[model samples]
Target chain A: MVRRDEFVLNVELSAEPGEVIVLLGPNGAGKSTLLEVLAGVLRPDTGRISVAGVLLDDTARRLHVDKARRRVGFVVQDYLLFPHMNVVENVAFGLRARGMRREHAQSHAIAWLERMGLEGFERRKPRELSGGQAQRVALARSLIVDPRLLLLDEPLAALDAGSRPKVRAELRRHLESYPGCTIVVTHDPIEAMLLATRVVVLESGEIVQDGTPSELARHPRTEYVARLVGLNLLRGTASGTVVEVGPHAVVAVAREVSGAVYVAFPPHAVTISTDRPVGSARNVWPGRVTDVEAHGDLVRLTIDGTVPMLADVTPVAVADLGLGPGSDVWASVKASEVTVYPA
Target chain B: MTHRRPHDWRVPPVILVPALVGLGLLLLPMAGLLWRAPWARFPDLLISESVVTALRLSVMTATAATALSLLGGVPLAWILARSRLPGLTVVRGLVTVPLVLPPVIGGVALLMAFGRRGVVGSWLDQLFGVSIPFTTVAVVLAQTFVAMPFLVVAVEGALRTADHRYDDIAATLGASPWLIFRRVTLPAVAPGILAGAVLCWARALGEFGATITFAGSFPGTTRTLPLEAYVAIGAGDIDTAVVLSVLMIGISVTILIALRGRWMRAT
Candidate 1:
């Protein structure tokens, strides 16, 4: 439904109807701006935009479609509901703008509220709605227009942590039900993975990575993505298979390393030791504890030595080892567990 | 952010006393007039036909003047607040000239522009075979000339300080510029417009020098409440004058209270 001659999006986006695409980035990634350009609110500075085979913005010829004429819906970051209008009125506003009669438009608005499970709350004002409910109202308001393209800006962003999961699920269902091309913009990787069929990661206004959730999990290209996938981060120097961290700790890696190399291992693979155990695992370090943080059923121990290592342990192991800040401990890891790459 | 406001509650009594006393000073004359007003003759003064005509004329013409201001001043304020037009500062200043210019000068300016023998008045008279000065229309124009700027300035300030996101939301929701203004912008600024309208209408009702100079002090034609009160005082009819003054204040207070609730609920 969408095409452009030399769209030059840098990353190819070819989604069939009802497919949801998530654009993930850390603030100022040009995600919302891209959506605005697509919606015809902003003119593409050097490209073309089309939806459902109609030209919207063509910068070359200076042709542009007015935002009102373009059938694209946008849900902004804070769920910009018209405070002057009640929930039903806000939903009907777009339909009325499109020349629908008041009665028919309001009926359509009520139908949309029913779809979002907000039927009984029609007459309530926007400020009176809870965060999740208001978000649903904003969604219903956009969808009632029967648009060809829908753009959501951080749909679950304004939600509290406890309300996020339910709103996220509800939003996912709404996106699936909308029979149109949809794009969701978010900075949360997990939200993108759960909500979008394909996740496009943007950084500094550039698409750094774009793939399915599993693809990104398997081969994360950037340090941020690697960290997000929960890898132990380390910076050090390397010469051939031997890598030196700080002064005393030297480890062997499979890659033909030279100069600077970063070594990472999953916290699960890092084993804690109180003594030098007999093992063939090439990586071991003696260190004092710096900090301990609980993550779910495991405790992550931060130990400092020639090479600082993180050891994840269960509650039983923690009690037995008495690990805490300033506690003496030894950490060990298998050579196979460490993944090394040139910096 | 500065957490501590160093200037709070430390003012010298010398400034605050007279500042309050000045208000008391302004209100004392009205209180004295009421206290000394002839109670027995109040019925005669209140039921006088001329007084009734002037009060009704004042109420009707002030409202008409307010309507005229809203019809023209709102769009001008919106443009001043939103657009990037050249010479806008000068235009805004020009719009506010009525607030600073003497009412007599404004009356003369209006007279020159629309009077039968004046600059644009000649062509208007020739084309329409009509005269504006010394008519009810002249009364309305003169009041609007001196009062509409209040509505424009208040509304423009409100527009400038308003939450601008509603317009953006409306635009994204497929509202055209005109639709956005009509729906979002107007509702958001309605309180300010209402407040300004009340002030404009009150000022219009109380207009004296401009109405008398431009519209002339003819009986039953251009004689509004304020002009009636001025003439009664000049004719040594002090009780009738107080009655008219009280009537104007009463109407102004009623309008203010009526609009106050609208603004309160809006906010």
Candidate 2:
């Protein structure tokens, strides 16, 4: 899908019933564009999209379903609850449009509202509800139609920092109870980890990696994913268990690999010292500190050397080593902490 | 709400003088009309045969003209504001041409297009044995010619400013285009439509040049209040003219006040 020439979405993925697939990517990575295509709001330029074995779109066959006819529930980041409609009316909108009687549709809407934990907000307008309440109302509105596929675009992004965790947990519960193919688009790694059964990493309109949350955290293929997961990634050539990241820098991992490879280890795994360490670890590099930053209880140091690396040291250790910009130091990590994989 | 800000006392004379002058310019004429009105004979003058007939005819023709404008102008406004038809800019410009055209010129243009011996009028006369000029129907056509732009322009602006995302959401909820229009779009823009109808009615009721030029002033058949006032002045019956003018002003002000409280204030 070409979204206003903003970005091209070249996604080939699917979600099974009872499974939630999170599209994890930074802004403008076409995560929302892919969701729109699946929701039938945006048509794909050239591709086939089938949900539960029904072809929603097939460019070669010249078959496409309009947004209205597609049985997909879309909950956008803004919640987009009709401001003029009270909570009950907003939730009953789909049933009313489907030709249900007013009383019956409203009764069903009330039931959905109660399920969403919005029992007393039935008469409140959208503007009267809190952010979390509005989100629940939007979800109830979309789910009342019993859609075959559910699409959520940054469902928790609109909540404040203090309420995000609470709403995130609630949304995860709702997604778990929903018996439909689910697709969620988000840029927050914590949200993705908490909500997704499987995470698909999107970068520059392409799927860079797709795996379970733990699997992606342990092995990220792209710098974007690595940065999101707080890992230091280096691309180099590998022979056996050693990867040549620089002229004098090599990392030894547990796996034996050859040719192009990506090596990753979390910043917390690296230790910084004023002098070269005498240890059995397989990776060590002497470098000059380029930048220093405070990360909670730890101080992060960016070092320039044979291989640029980030090391997270405790504040006490940083004080002991007098680590600052332009200071010389050696950073070391054990061989077991580094993971090497084919590019 | 009435807590006034302290006066700066540095009011610019240039603005204050003209502002008061403009208010006086509008209010002085109404005051003069009221001063000269024959209050004692107002009841007798209002109940006269000619005055009653002209008032009745004016209300009927203007109402008809307003209904016609609503029927045609509303759909035109929707198309102009919502459709992706090519060369829409040109179509939109043409729709507003009536607003800028002088009513007499519009009357002449209408006559040229719908006259008995001219263009479509000739075909109409031949095919249906219908001649529209100098008839009550001609009065409605003339008023509509000069008044339709108000409705179309108002409704089009409303349509453009309304939140179209609601329409998209409604469609995704399984509403067809027609149902969306009737239930969602129409209710959202009702204030604009009501305001437009009020403007169209007032313009039609006060129409003189176009109605006189195209339909002529035949006593009960085509003569409306404004035309009757003109005739009264021509006959040197200044009292009758004053009575008719006062009645027209009174009716328009009452209706506009009622509408303002509900529709125009929605802006």
Candidate 3:
């Protein structure tokens, strides 16, 4: 348990060796706080934290290990590379602090930096490097220490949009090569999906959902997760092939689920028409166009009606339908497209 | 697009006139000192035994005082800047009392605390037969008492402004607090410490009231350059006094120039 201000975070978390778990959450969701606790920078009020079977913190017994001895490497959001030290000196800091010879530490740090594709930049200061370069140096600094557990908070959030994808891929490769369990915190769903072997969704200081990327994409448990995965989710009571969601009935491919359940379908699966859609579709509702946004090649239209939903149509289709905010429209989804799962 | 030239900017006479007057007021004394200096016997007077001894003593004690201040002031500054303890504002105000307190009053306070028959001084005398007044040690103590506040204030400001996240980063990198302070905090705040030390040294070199009261002026013992100049003036040796004043002005100008950027911004 950790109480900061009026926010209280009580979570029980564990990771196996070689598992890359991404803590996915929005800002102020206690993602960074969790990392700080794991790194021993902030002691939890009451908990038992043991890394690799070595007891690091047990508030019950008043056994809290000092942060310096926790052996947990944390890469902060801003990649706080020491402004005073050169790249090599910053990377070698941990080794030097642990009593290793300066020459030995430098050689080791150089090897690590070279592996990170940062050769000949040893003499450069942090300010001299680009955002991506500084991030790599921060990573090398933490990884060279060979910590038992690694925590990265928004590892690629500092990069420019053009460089984020490249750095994210490179970070993924580095995380895979590390032998220890790694927990990455990020608000970007795409980043979480790309990096995490398992994703834990946190909201309001609680874990709302924990599953693999595909599992979450297929059956998101909450509206936040559904929105993050670009799906329309509706909670309702289900019986056989139909679920009564809000004021509208959604038909799904035959499933054995009953009682409280969630109905989900991709935005692409939703079709919109200026007039009522006529098809074999089992679910249809008339709604006014609430919002229209250009999403890559498709224009996503948010329709508000008996069953509020989002539909993705091409720009040409949007032109034909004359879709804009306040335009009356009908949204339909085929029974096969709707997925039903227990709430 | 056209750009404004540097000369396009102007300072209004309302502000510029008095600013110039203030500058002139400050420079007039140095000009008078230089004009009245004994250039003819300057070499003879500069190398005199008393002048040399006093100069040596001033430099030695000022440096010793600066060093002592650094030893105790840095940690005190860290606590003042970072500690979350209650009443720290009061403690910080108390630490700066010496900066505003008259040096003679500070000298009297020091006498009450460390002089023979004084609080700590009486105990030391009873146990070890040690006496501090009228000695070189007393001169250093008095100088440190008056000058250390400068170092502490400067360092505390620097620490307060420095990025504290770096300490957390160092800790996560497996650095003990002592190691972090030695390798990271110390290096990061070095410029502040250097500037503070310079100020402390300058103040100590000019210290007179506290030294004269707490440590009596004795040639070759505690009679620093300032005391020597005072003695010269008391004996009506106007030429020697002028020479000493010119020397001090030269030293002060050199320090001001060396620390112009940091000192100006600090003030």
Candidate 4:
């Protein structure tokens, strides 16, 4: 638990030594606060934080380790490199601060920089390097200290779209070989999917979902997670193959399970037509187009009817159907297209 | 087609007239000093024993005052910029009071606080058989009392504008608070401290009213160049006074030139 003025955040998290956990959340979700607490920068009001079997914080015992002794490396979103120092000095700062000799620290920093593919860039300042290069230097700076846990807050958010993929892949490769637990905070689901061994979704200071990337993509528990993974989710009670979702019943082809369940399907799984669909689609309902938005090459329409849902259709199909707001339309979904999981 | 240069914007008379007047007001005095300087006696006056003693004393006392200010003012500035203690506004106001208070009044306040019969000074006199007034130490103290506000204000401004997240990052990198301050915070604000020290030294070099009141103008002791100039004027030695004034003006111009880059960036 951490309190900042009137806002209070309570979170319980743990990661194994060889795991890369991504804390995925929207803005104001308290993800960065959790990382700060874990890194021993902010003391919790009432909680215990232990890393590698060593107790770092225990409010009951009134034991709190200083941040300098916690062996936690934190890289912020903007990568606050010491602007006055050169690249080698910046990377060697941690070692020098820990009482190592200057020459030895510089040599170690050079080795780490070379490993990060930053050779011949030791004397260059941070401003002279590209965003990606600076990020790698920040990582090298943090990793040189051999921390027990590494915390990166939106590590790749500073990169341009052109370099994001290459930098992200390189970051993933580096993280794979690290021996400590790593926690990365990002709001981009694609980034979370690409970098996380397990993704923990945080919403409004609470953990809403925790699972593997594929598990979260296949089954999202809340509207935020569902929208993040680009899926339509609805809560309902399942009675064999038919599930009462909202005001309408949705028939799903899954193992027979009778209880509260969630029905999830992609927007592209939903088909919209000006006239009522009457073929092999197991479920069909008449709905009016409430909103239309362009989603890449497909046009996504929010239809409101018996079961309000989102439907994605190609631009060509939208022009043919003349889809617009307030246009009456019939939405249909095949039984096999919807996946059911216990809520 | 002819194009207007981007730098050739027309200045309105409303602003241009006062701007030129302000420039003239600042430059005309220096020009008058140059015009009235005793050129024939310049070398003789510059090498005089009394002039050398006063100049050496002035430079030494001003540097000592600047050093004292840095010793106390840097930590005070950090507290002012970073601490969230109660009544800090009152503390800041008190620290800056010297900037606006009359220097004579500052000397009187210093006397009340550190004179022979004053609060702390009385105890020191009784316990240690020491008196601070009418000594070179008193001159340095007076100068420091009047000039330290410049250093504090400059350093606090720099600390306020510096990104504090760097401190947090340093801490996470296994740096103790003291190490962070020495290795990170100090270097980051070095330019500000240098500018502040220069301003403090310049102000201390010209301090006269406070020194005359508290330290008294004792030759080879508390009589700095400014006091020497005042004594020369009172004795009707106008050439000596003009020479000393020109020497001080030259030093002031050097300081201004040294700080030109910072001033330009600020503007």
Candidate 5:
């Protein structure tokens, strides 16, 4: 477990064995710094880190464990392989360093290489391997040490398009088999969803959202999170106990607000109407059709109007409304659909 | 891009003249020596007993010098290149002194420091009944003093330019400093070290001033090829001197060829 709080990052996480927790965030979000702090490559300005229930680093108490004794496997953005050593020797390094004899170390390395699906690459140097192959060799070398924790920094980001899917699948299989707490750092939503049991979204060195992928997609507290969850987020003012998005759109919320605020709604909330409807929801707009995308079992429509709204209506509704490029559409939403929060 | 010249016209008079001049400056001496060869007496002059003994001593002492450089200079380069100790820059400068120091003056400096009445030399003599001056050991010492710096500087530069993340990787793999140095650092710089060793050996074989100043001219004990040539020149034996020079040049050229084939292919 690692926790850091300085500038903007204030994260507290305790990962159990066999759990893959991915730290996901955009660039400059301090995701790499968090991983570095956890891997003992960087020291936190103020934090406490414990691994296997042992207090590894407690900056408040001036306690810090050296990286060499951290027993954590780290894979950086670029696979930092020793070019001089062949695959077998590179894998055998950790064992030899821990006082294993050359023959025994080599045997263990061979076994791990075989596990990584690199059986016959023992004699090849790091320069001879492709990106994915090098990543696998790096994984084999790191795992052969049997570290207590595993840290991967954008492991699949360095791969090309043709190699990405295959390598990601291979890495997923390896992560499943690794019986240790693994923390993978990445900002790609698909990668986080595919590889992580739980996702921690960091922004400007702070954990803004931490939850299961489904949960975060449904409820996001920040615009960054909303964008990541693919929600059309908007901000507006409130008047007369009603949050007014604009002249044509206003929603009565549970809270009585008198000033500026933020309102977020999932794309599925809006209902496309050919004409304005008589309703208590008090939100209506004749919008210009801006964008259209096919979601699972639904067609997502983006319309520019008094308040630009993304509506996830069924394809049947799309066809019924005759919605296509350059057509007028009325989008209406109930007050309850808008999640109004103080800005 | 920097010069803004067309690729086809890149080697115009502005570049070609200087390039040819530089090549000529480097090759003109070897050309002159070959042109002035006394080809008729070369075999007889080269086959003399003194010539043979000097050649053997040159091989022996130069090899010993190279061995000494590898044993001591590699670690020195590592320390200078990697360590952050105080006075490090000063130490690095001192290591390269032999490269710029006049060879004769360097020999005199060696004599002043390790001579019979010199500080360390007197104690060594008194404590162990050992004297190092004007002997085969002295010849080796003189050669090493001048040649070891080349190896150290070359290796230190290589080490400084090496990828340091390999050290971090090794550390995470449970490798302590010594193991990393032996398994990673040493092997990574092996080619540079080898190149330096070859250059050091060649320099030692051709060393003239230091050998004569520190280790005086003596047959079978101190007379390496250069000292033998100097002695032959003094005795009006120009043919023998030329033969020794040619032999030394030949040995150094062979080493260059072998190393070029072995390691320089990477460049």
Candidate 6:
């Protein structure tokens, strides 16, 4: 779809039934905009949107379905629960809007809330619920309508770190049981990996990569995706098994891929040594440590050499090798650890 | 609880002096009204037929005017707050014109617009033999003409400040625009609507210049509380005028006090 003079997004990915397609992008990359377009909250300049064979919007035909009739459930990032409504009222909102009898809606809402493990929270206002409970209520509210296409924007982003894991797991279970097309938008790689059956990477309002979680982790196309997957990406010309990255420096890859190719290896795969390694490591380069940072239980050393590389070493290893800024070190990687793929 | 002193030591002379002066300035007239009031004949004056007629007329007209203002002003406020129509700023400025315009001038403007042989009134007269001036309908129209701005302005501010995302969410939940308005928008801005109604009712109750100029001061028809107060004072019946003024003040204060709890609780 095109937004005149601002940005043009050309995305064409379809979600299969019961498949959770995670739209992964940084801020201002049109993830939320795409969600809005699908939910009928926004009218695309020129596009045709059909959900489950029902046309929702057709700009060329000048036919735009009303948002209220789209049969699409949209759960925004902040939940956006009505402040004046209690949990039961919020959950029953969709049914009531669809012209359900008030008593039937209330009973259905209670059943949904019970299914969400929120039986006692029926009368509690939105503000009174904790972050996890609020997220559950939002999920319940959206799911109660049994929409054909469910759109969730950063479902777990508003949650605090303490409750994020439990809520994320619960949300995944709910999504797995949903028998409709689901599109979730998020920037966190872990959330994408945990929730997405397929990941669609968006960069600058364009689709850069679309693949399964393992495929994306194995072969990332951009630096952002590479960083997100926690892999060091290097682009070089490959001739057979040897890839020439810089002058007088060639790295050997186990797989033979000719022409332009990319090699990615985990930061932990690169073992830092004070001297040149005298082992089965095929790729080794002497470089100066540019920066040092703590990554979980390991110390990540940023090395400037033939190619900028990230090498993770344990804190004990850092003390043993005296690794710090401006320190000269040899970064080595096993040929088997590097995954080479066509660019 | 410990015994309390008559005056707190923390009261600074600068603030205390002006505060007391301001209190005296406000209360001095009320004190004088009470001091010169015919207490022995107070019940007799209140029960008099003219006083009863004017009081009843004031209540009924003010209520009708408030109802009219709410019905018209709410839609206007919604348009101002939600729509991006052209010349909206100008329309909003014009809506608040009555708030700043002198009541007498507003009455004249209403006369020009709704009076017999005037603009719409001329058409109304020739077409239907209906005249608005010098009638109970005229009193209500005059009150609404001068008091609607308060309701519109208050409700507009509330609508502007209210979260519109709730409306968007409601729409996505399959609620039509009107349903969304009734269930979501109305409740969200109910306090503002209530406050505006109160202000409009109070202004209508005390309306003098507008009702007299546009509707005329006819007993049992348009001589409301403020108009009655004016007539009483002009006729040298200071006791009646004082009593009418105090009654108007008392009614307004009572209503405000009664509603304060509800508005505060909602907020």
Model number with the top lDDT: 4
- The best-first sequence of candidates by lDDT reads 4, 3, 6, 2, 5, 1
- Could you give the CAPRI-style class of model 4? high
lDDT of each model, Cα atoms only?
0.84, 0.89, 0.91, 0.93, 0.85, 0.90
**Poorest 10 consecutive residues by lDDT, candidate 5 chain B:** B1-10
DockQ of each: 0.58, 0.52, 0.76, 0.81, 0.56, 0.70
The residue-by-residue lDDT of candidate 5 on B1-267, one tens digit each, is: 377555565667978999999999989978877777688988887888999899899899999999999999999999998887999999988988999999999889888878888888888888988888898998999999999999998899899888877777777777788888998888888888998999999999999899899999999889999989889889998778878888888888899899989875777
Q: Is candidate 1 or candidate 5 better by lDDT?
A: 5
TM-scores for every predicted model: 0.83, 0.91, 0.94, 0.96, 0.81, 0.93
Report the CAPRI category for model 3.
Answer: medium
Model 6, DockQ value? 0.70
Query: Best candidate per TM-score, number?
Result: 4
**Which tens-of-lDDT digit does each residue in A1-343 have in candidate 5?**
2334445566778889999999988898888877778777677777799988888899889999887788889888788888878999888889988999999999999999988989899999999999999999999888889989999999998888888888999999999999999999987888888899888888876787888877667666677878777786776788756877767566666567778887777778788887777776567778888888888988988798877867888988888888887778888777777777665
- Model 6: TM-score for chain B: 0.93
Error of 2 at A181 (Å): 0.6
- Model 2's TM-score against the true structure: 0.91
Interface Cα RMSD of candidate 5: 1.3
After superposition, the stretches of candidate 4 with alpha carbons farther than 4 Å from their true spots are A248-254, B1-5, B261-267
> In angstroms, how far off is B91's CA in candidate 6?
1.1
Deviation in Å, model 3, residue A277 alpha carbon = 2.8
In angstroms, give how far residue A287 of model 2 lies from its true place.
3.4
Best by DockQ: 4
Worst lDDT run of 10 residues, candidate 4 chain A, spans A246-255
Worst ten-residue run, lDDT, model 3 chain B? Answer: B258-267
Write candidate 4's Cα lDDT for A1-343 as tens digits: 9888867788888889989999999899999999999988789999999998999999999999998899999998999999889999999999999899999999999999999999999999998999889999999999999999999999999989999999999999999999999999999999999999999999888899999999999999999999999998889998888898875556565568789999888999998888877699887888899999999989999988878888999999889989899999988898888889999
Q: What is the C-alpha RMSD of each candidate to the true structure, in Å?
A: 5.6, 3.1, 2.5, 2.0, 5.6, 3.4
State fnat for each of the candidate structures.
0.62, 0.43, 0.85, 0.91, 0.68, 0.79
